[model samples]
Each structure stands twice: as structure tokens, then as C-alpha cells.
Target: MRRSGATLDFDVDTTSGHPLYIPNGDLLTANKWHHVVFTWDGNVTGTNAKWYVNGVNKTLANIAGSGSRTSDSGYSPYIGALCSGCYFNGQIDEVRIYNRALSAEEIKRLYLLGN
Candidate 1:
């Protein structure tokens, strides 16, 4: 994902296939900080993945596929942005990754903690 002026770009993906790129819309405002959390459980129905912004659930409705991320991806996860020369133009703080997906309440708690 990326930040462009007042909008936040979003893309959902799994271990395989093309990424599900979501168009820029609500869930973000300009000149403010937001707590963003992405949770994916890999199920096709009944909440397979979610996107939370500022402790509110803002996951898009039309998720394309059964987004399943593999346990191991060979390369290590990189914070801030991707490695292939795609740099983030905005600031990032308190980034975290877990071996398992976090629940909504847990994400909200972390958001309230601010790190």
C-alpha cells in the first residue's frame, strides 16, 4: 500500500496469484495519523481478511479470492516498504508483525496503546 496526498492505497494478496488492489476511497483523511491493521485468516467466506483503520473495521467488501499467505516466504519480511526500489514517501512508526493474525479487539488495544 501507499499514501498519495489525502488517500491511502491498498492491495490484498496471498502467497500466490495477482494482488487484489483496492481503489482509494474512505477510511483515510489527510494530515492525520491512523492506526492501520490487516488481518487475514485465509478463509473464502466469513471474514477471511480484514483491514482496520484507527480501530475501526474498514475492510472492503469485495475481496477477490481466498487470500492465504504461506507460513514461510523464503525472504524475511521488511518493514516500511518493499525492497525493489519502492520507497515509502511518508513516515512509519511502531510497525509489528505476528506469527498469527490478531483479533479486532487486540488490534484496537494496540492502537490505543500507540505502540
Candidate 2:
């Protein structure tokens, strides 16, 4: 995930080709703490992507491209950036990735736990 201006760019590379990209604007306040959760069931059909902000589902459905989500974990994940130009202009504290998509209740628990 990369913050492009006030919105976020969620990109997940797929095994069958094409990367999934989701965009949501003004989802975060500068210099403030926010809990964002993105869930995908590995099947992209221009939908089925959910964005939970602060424990509530924001209903983001603008997924670009299509394919099965990648299962390879050989590549290293970068926090603030994937390259020079595309970089998150804020601080990132902790990040967690799961094997499967988490439920709404589980995501809420995480937000509540942090608070």
C-alpha cells in the first residue's frame, strides 16, 4: 500500500497476471493515527475488495485489473515505498499480513486492541 497524495494506492500482484489496484481518497488525516485493513479473497473481478478504516468498512469497490492473488512470498515487502517516487510521506508503525482475508469482527478487534 502506498499513499498517493491524500488517497491510498493498494496494489496486489497476481499469479495469473495483472495487479489489483484500489484507490480511496482523503482516507487519512495527516499526522494522525489510523487503522486501515484491506481484504481480498484472491479472486479479483473488479470487486470483492474491502477497506476497513478505524474498524468500519468503507466499501471500496474500484479494483483495477484482474487475476488470482499471488502466493509467492519470496519478494521482500517494503513499508513506506516500493520505489523512489512512490513513497508514503508519513510514518508507519506496525504492519501485519495474514494468509487469508480476515473477518469484519476480527478487524474490529484489532482496532479495539490498539486503542
Candidate 3:
């Protein structure tokens, strides 16, 4: 996804059910909050996909596929808030992505980073 205005870029894979977040436009504003989460239900192979932010989950599912791509070719990218041209003007802290659905314990961990 591309950021036109103040927003974020993300993509979800239907085959693996994994969500990927990408920062296309520019750095976030200072002293603000920005985060992202990704969950997968199938298999994740290779490292084609990665969390741009620090402290995010690296590998997700255990199932292996034929190819070594992080995302499938047929899935459409998901964009949030920001569009192309426009950019975010705030501080971004503690971006998180999970392979399986996050439990209450995991959510709390993320919250702690922001606070």
C-alpha cells in the first residue's frame, strides 16, 4: 500500500492469512503512536516479508510451501489510513505483528511498549 496522506500501508495474504505492514511514504511524526499487527493461519516460508519497525515478530507459521516467498502472488495488499503522496506526521512507536492470533498476554506486551 502507498501513503497519499497521513496513513500506513499493509497487506494480507489469503493463502497464508498473514498480514504484512509496509511504510511507504515517510517517517512518522515525533511524540505520536504508530503500530501494526499481522496474523497468519497457514505457512510462512523465507523472509520476503518483514516488519519495518523494530521489536516485531520475525517468523510466523511452521508450515512450509513450495516457493520461498513471504507472501503469495495472488493476495491483494491492504492499506490503512495513509494514501499515496500524503504522509503521516506523528511519532511511531512499538509496531507489532503476530503469526497466530495474539492472546491477551501478547496484547498487554504491546501496550506496555506504547505506554
Candidate 4:
């Protein structure tokens, strides 16, 4: 997301069926250069999942889940601005994506640089 008069930008996404759910109350705000990248492979065979913000590993309770099963290997890749029809209102600079999930350290580095 972008803000008026800001130089940096932010972009984030996840793998297929491994959707990123940014709740209405949780909005990313940046005053300068910043970027966020998220990816998931939809590996649901095991009951394990993870979430990161600005490249930092967040606790499992911090991530939103369906409580049943979440996988990222589906055919259709889920990408958008907000969860459940909520549109982002800030100016977004750039967004990038990778087919595979990023390591915890990688996410932190990206987030630090963006911020």
C-alpha cells in the first residue's frame, strides 16, 4: 500500500489457496520506502502453517485461519488487495511474488529494507 508524498511502496502475496487475510482493522502504513512479500505452497497434508509480517515470524495465533484446513497447492492462485471484499485505500508502489515460500530471515530482511 502507498501513502501520499511517500517514496516507497508495499507488495505482498501468497501461493495458491494459501490466502493472505489482512483484517479490516489491520492496515499497513508507511512513511517512506517499504515492501512486503508473502507466499504459501498450500501444503495442507500436515497440520502446520506460518505467517510473517514485514519479514518477521508472527505467532500462529496472530494469523487468521479457517480452523479446518488451509492449503496452498490449489490450481487457482488467490491474489487481491483485501480480504472479503475490503479494498486498500493507500497508494501502493510495487508488488512481487515467488512460486515458493520465503524463509523467515528473508522476509525480515525485505521488511526492514522497505520500512
Question: What TM-score does prediction 3 earn?
Answer: 0.31
Model 4 C-alpha lDDT per residue in residues 1-115, reported as the tens digit of each score: 2212322122233332332333223325555333445444543321234455556544432233333343425534323333445444454555676667788877777777765
lDDT of 2 by residue, 1-115 (tens): 7776666656666755656455455688888899988887766564667888899887564666655666647866766676566678778877999998999999999999999
Cα TM-score of candidate 1: 0.66
- Give me the runs in candidate 3 sitting further than 4 Å from their true place: 1-82
Using TM-score as the measure, the top candidate is 2
lDDT of 3 by residue, 1-115 (tens): 3333543444444444544444444534545554554443343442343323223443423223343335446644333433354444444344444456665457557656665
By TM-score, how accurate is candidate 2? 0.79
Error of 2 at 82 (Å): 3.1
Ordered list by lDDT, greatest first: 2, 1, 3, 4
Q: Score candidate 3 by lDDT.
A: 0.43
- Candidate 3 lDDT at 42 equals 41
Write one digit per residue (lDDT tens) for candidate 1, span 1-115: 5544544444444555434433336666656777887776545432556777888777464455545654545755544444567666666777787778898889899889984
TM-score of 4: 0.46
RMSD per prediction, one decimal? 3.7, 2.5, 10.8, 7.6
Q: What is the lDDT of residue 112 in candidate 3?
A: 64
Stretch of 10 with least lDDT, candidate 4: 2-11
